[model samples]
Target chain A: MSDSPIVNEFNQGPISCHAFNGDRTELAICFNTNVVTIFRKSGASWTQTSTLVEHDKPVTSIDWAPKSNRIVTCSQDRNAYVWTLDGASHQWKPTLVLLRINRAATFVRWSPEEDKFAVASGSRCISVCYFEEDNDWWVGKHIKKPIRSTVLSIDWHPNNVLLAAGCADMKARVFSAFIKGIDKKPAPSPWGEKLPFNTLCGEFSNGAGGWIHGVAFSPSGESLVFTGHDSTITVVSPGTGDIQSIRAPYLPYLSVIWLNENQIVAAGHDCAPHLFERKGQQWAFSASLDAAVKKADVGFTARDTFRRMDSRAQSTTSTDTEVHTHHQNTINSIRSFSGTPEHVEQFSTSAIDGKLILWNADSISRGLGNLHL
Target chain B: MAFRKIDIDALEEDAFGEDEIDFQEIGELRPVADVDAQVNSRAQEVRSLLQRGNTSGALSTSLQNPPYGAPFHAAKARNTQTVMEVLNSIKVSDVPQLVKSLSPEEQDVLMKYLYAGMAAPEQNNSGHLLAWHEKLTEVAGQGCIVRVITDRRTV
Candidate 1:
């Protein structure tokens, strides 16, 4: 609808999304209905890579393994399914189905170094499973705790030996890996002789009326940053056990990603994405998109169409008052990739308001010469 | 009924029959029974406040508006006497020697508080210099006491 570049648009509707590989060349979009669509970008155009329909419930989370060609998807049915891309048929097929977990899996992450994957269950436990060469998946470890008041978010350490999980209890816990015989002998147990991974560290009180929704570790793995419904962003020194809390004017930061060591990008409940930088001993807001621009970028634009639609929305909003006055859906999530100095790509937000809006960060940084004010 | 002003000097001369007053007689002076009871009750109130983690309020109440004939007056007097005695025992010249006896970790901890002027007064003989020296000794290993004294001269 605008002059912004549209990477791709899906008529089937996308509810959740994840990248297919490290390069983010392919994207997998999960629908509210049972369908999952894979799209690929080719020469400024997006082609439907493949569409798979296997789940009866909405897909809650999707993750791509670091060392394998497999994709993992967990849904409301309380099962995690693994899919592999078949080059010959140009289709994605379910390879391994892990069932009988007895709880809905909300988040899934792949370890950085190994074939191990961490899945957060609704029952307040993180299950660590590893894929074997024989194409079979085995539960390697399980970190269990008391029943949480709500579902928790879990992420793997950047180097893969540690796992960090955030609970409704308002605490973030870290668990480190222990190798049998090399580091310590694994005690024999009924759940398999896997080394007992205990909580090495924990922080904050969920009872303080702030529930930690998401937790992310810096790329260097030296510091941990977390956001909660309390509208507070906390930076914790894992080494010293010191916490520095900064409150955002808007409460409930839904998601956060590390742009680099010193900078963090977050999406707030206000439907705006904010960039923050660690200045001296405190974190300060650097930049934020206006509400109108955020709405236009996330609403009508589809995932691949986001990059192209961004510029057009900006131009139209400047000249047209009606377009500026329109109410749009809130942005739910944002994903940015590192690209060449000339171009940067971001993906899937609220498609109802045109989510797929792309901008050239390098050019924008040089000055808004190309943009119409 | 009107009050009469008596000559206290002449009365002391008649009572003790000495130019110098008897210190023992002065010690025997006591308040009325009701006054003593009231003072003790108020002292208990202050102690309870301190125990309840209201240090700032307790300190303010005791120092700013002490109860008349408060029993805590005697305790405060004794604490001051003890602090004075401890301060009198330390020689200004021995500060460097005392500082040299502390360990490295102890030296760092003590130096941080000394530089910030946060060292406890009672523990440091009530002198800023003495407090800094005492803290330095406590942190630096006793074996490095000599190094502290020599380093103090260079600085």
Candidate 2:
């Protein structure tokens, strides 16, 4: 239980986003640059397999459809590309998506069915794109009515017809992304019935009014949770109209993922992921995944103490520059790496410090007894 | 008579869609209570507690149910003033003890007041606020400052 997480350093740059293939053998990551690199796992280490370079600007997000074996990448260039493996050429091919957005595209996610995908942009709109067979190209339908600011993050409901977006305007909204021919009429749920395209089923904010940084739905798609810049995570159940907000004693979280129906892991500027659990109708901060250790317990010696006193006027041996957490800088993104949505066995995080870490649920659950992950 | 074909894209480009106003739901949806009277009474109680040298009690009193909603800006301001006065009255040496006695929620509220006091240096003593700020951060860590800066609810 005291073992450290698996740490990998892709020294190219900070990984802005990353996605894994169905078998977790391949990884597609954007190194905060215009290029997206694909890495294939060779034993314990990963080696670069290829680079997809279509965007003229820094790529912001990347997502791989596990079932379809396709990758979608969106960038600040206001464009998105879907990459498919060409069997004859034995190379990855890029297909452009007509986003038609004037501003940078920030985030992208494939729907549950992988038949369509949504791209969130700084243009204050979301482009729900689908393949058009007649034109032999992809076309996008815009959801532009209610969003007043840039959308920061987005999540898809399991039903594949609903999209949840977190915006800089400090609101999280649930909208129907139901396309006429691509999606069937979704069954009635707690969100709403008679689902039409761009139908806003719900809107919410963390009462303190911080910009929403991340949003996610429960495994069953019955509950939604969003992390706000105000250092709070809010959970809402549209069925009961119950909204529960819990503010943790940590820095704001930029990303959140559900480990199970009742458990959530969120990480961001704090540089470590924290766990939140639901007990009955209430949700509260349960534990910090990266448990804090006493600094004096390790690496503080008499020589270091004298050196610290010699360098600075301080008499203490504490290192002021280094954080005690696993991640040295802000964690920009977190994704479920393994297990079912009902119980994610492992998860991964990428940070500004050019490190990608994989955390195991078994070790964490063992360390913190009574936790079910 | 031949009818002209309507291009949906062209119509969307020329026509204006209904703009949705993003209002803070906390302020408008929650009905305004008698916040002015409550804040005034709390201020008086906090002042009395400070005079009696009960800094911990004064802090709890000042932080309890801070007046929110847009309708009671005056009360919020007055409460901020009262909190600043209480903060200034505490001795520098007693800051650690006072901060440690506060719960996490109280510490967050105190942080909001510390920032508010620092914002208006003319109204509050900067040295006293800085002393309190250092102690609070030591007890609560950097998250308190982040919350104070990002949270929309002001003192």
Per-candidate interface DockQ score:
0.01, 0.33
Task: Report residue B32 deviation for candidate 2 (angstroms).
Answer: 12
Instruction: Give the least accurate 10-residue stretch of model 1 chain A, judged by summed lDDT.
Output: A364-373
What docking grade does candidate 2 earn? acceptable
lDDT of 2 by residue, A39-95 (tens): 999987899989999999999999999999999999999999999999998799999
The DockQ-based CAPRI class assigned to model 1 is: incorrect
Q: What is the C-alpha lDDT of each candidate?
A: 0.52, 0.87
